[model samples]
Target: MKVRFYFITITLACLVLTACNPQTNQIEKTQAPQVIEWEYQIAYQRGMEAVTWSLPAVSMICMRNASFNLGGGYNTVYWLSEIPTAKQEALTANNQTPYANVYLNTKNGPVVLDIPPASNKTALFGSAVDIWQEPIADIGPAGADAGKGGKYVFLPPDYDGSEIEGCINVPSGSYQVFVALRCIPIGGATFKEAAEYAKNINAYSLAEINNPPQGNYIDIAGKHLPTLPDYDFSYFGYIKELMDTEPLQKRDMVMGGMLASIGIEKDKPFIPNDKVKSALTKAIADGYNYLEYMFETPGFSLIKQWEGRQWMNIREPSNDGFVFDEGEYLLMDERGSLFHWATFFPRHLGKATAYLNAMQDADGNLLKGEKQYKLTVPAEVPARDFWSVIVYSKKTKAWIYNDLGRVGLSSYDKENMKLNDDGSVDIFFSETAPEGMESNWIPTNGEDFFLLFRFYGPQESYFDKSFVLPDVQLLK
Candidate 1:
């Protein structure tokens, strides 16, 4: 019995040793010792953050050109061409001059106006044809006469002085208007000609301000304006330019940083060399590959659509060439002190308009005999540029009638605007007309119209919400 017990004990000892002792084969299997699951986690987080930081710089550059005088916004509309020609005509009959029409939507309706090269100012053509030209209107909307006290009219491009005063119905919603002259490619027109062209076709239509609907004016005192975040955004433009120049490097840094931030560490060393250099190289390469995979992912290829009216684009990092992305990437740090538009366009119109829907107010009721809604811009309104709350016709997609020959206001025109002691500005919207009020009125013509608030060089006040625009309200 003693001998049998001893044999059993010896067998148990051997088993124990095999389980606890390290083996050469086991160690060899893990040649890349520096790599571990946790290391990957860190790398991922860092890469994502890097991408977030770098994205908005592009938007800032785009925003500089987006201002009130120009009706600049993330998704502000631009007219590409206005060469009036018949569709059935042969190729030779079509005018290829690339004449364009810039448009803005106000409470009155969509304003479809065009500007041609003015023979007077050759020197101001480039800047004038920009969104910022003075004396902006030559001929106002043909639908201005179609006023039914509360109905909007449509105005086609070929709207000759016929009885076809384009007008339509108004839907219930909060709205604002943007007055945009046109877009001339970076070097498309001569500076003087563009400037003079802008001067000629200017102003929001308020021609109906006097006739019927009793009070004659639409109150917009509660209307709000769209604005950008406040930051030292000037530097952001330069950063975007640099990123465009060194695409690959920016990509590498972003990917690498993301991985690092996520706690991904270099765990395993290369074969036979448990050196730090090998491990580090592998770590970076892995991050790059992961980033590449993300770009090609199926979800990244599609564009984000907004409200059936606008189409937002997205950029694929791997796609070469001057390909433009449709969506804007937003970044707000934990404290909300930092706001970033990290996309090619600062405020992409389609997406921005979609976003605007969320904050829109419920407009007041409009009786058939009612004329207009009176509104006032809050004193603390946040924006770097001058602002004008114009009206747009939902049916005809054109601006309403005006006497000031103005559709919107700008910072440069501050002296010309009437302001409250608190710095707030007054604006009017109506289908008929406002008694005694002429210059600061936006005609809505009773149809549904959209509004846009443009900021030129926004300051910190705009982002912090210290300057809040009023909601659109009906005057009793």
Candidate 2:
């Protein structure tokens, strides 16, 4: 009876110790690995999309900042006498047009942009974008002014004034504005002439227009502009800066909440815990890979430009000004993919310009510089202003450098090129030009490259799919 009592007592004591001991309780609490909360996971995903979608705008701001740092400072227009060839470090830049840019900060009040009348052979276009890179308004030839010289007043978002006559009112969503102007020198006018025309463009505050500061132009022809951010944990820093810089629009509220959940709220220091930091780093990398996959795959909502051809348009033809039926909350993947493909360009659609890119030849093989290929442009290439075909490095997305300084062939220079017997033009891509066909050859210098076919002021044929661009045919 004593042994039984002792054994029973011992068992009871063990049970109580095991159940009530602090160490045991602590061990039980940590027995299973910590699982991330569902809410946290959802927040992470939304944050990833927010970052990806905002990357294009942030990248443009970074580019403008880089330019300001390199070519004088803000409010000073940087003019590029030479077109952006592959040597230029801009993001997916075209090599056919000379450009000038000025960064505007209208935190105090309105700023005035004085656009000069373009010469007869020059077509100039200017667009003012907020810090988020959203297009506020377009000036110059294709813009509201219709190439006539005028003063464009960039008003703040909270402005409550009556409309000013004579001056075009541009309401900016953010105080920081980027004004990029493209000057196309046509009809034998040189880039020097284009630079001269760009120099005449000026920017000043409406309050100081009477005694405005002299316009400053810094030539950035061969200078390198570092615009791409390091694809790592530091990218979040850029996102934070962008969030703080741009005013929160209604469309950004959801994203802002997501960001706040991750400790990236505006006006607050972003300090993610180790677990969240790890998750975010992985998420960013995954997002980039996903975007690259979208670029390679066929289902990015890409529009088929030509039948039996590899050329594809990145954005849908029917998208209203790059906005879908959902307005700002449109398809995230499609919009993110478009921005990833080309970072710093307005979504002007087919009106201002139509863009088509070809990565592979008609045989569906990746384009290589060691091989020769030909693209035959049918006569009357349906561009109201002009058209150009530029070769860009697949890896860099910049102009492909070669022995020939030419990175693009434009219709403006068609008289200097050799045409096919049928009035169509055959442009060749190869490391070596054929005998007497040098003018038609665009040297690739043994590098993998892609082609960007641009139609400025595209006609109805391009939109109707009637102006089909020929496939790139590989030649021995």
- Specify the highest-TM-score model's number: 2
Error of 2 at 400 (Å): 3.0
lDDT of 1: 0.33
Record all residue pairs in model 2 with backbone atoms less than 3 Å apart, i.e. clashing.
Answer: none
Worst 10-residue lDDT window for candidate 1 reads 124-133
Q: CA shift at 98, candidate 2, in angstroms?
A: 1.6
lDDT of 2 by residue, 319-339 (tens): 455543245354666656666
The TM-score of candidate 1 is 0.29
Work out the TM-score per prediction: 0.29, 0.83
Residue 317 CA displacement from its true place in model 2, Å: 7.3
Quick one: RMSD of model 2? Answer: 7.1
Off by over 4 Å in 2: 1-47, 297-301, 314-319, 324-328, 343-347, 366-372, 401-403, 412-419, 430-438, 445-447
Error of 1 at 338 (Å): 26
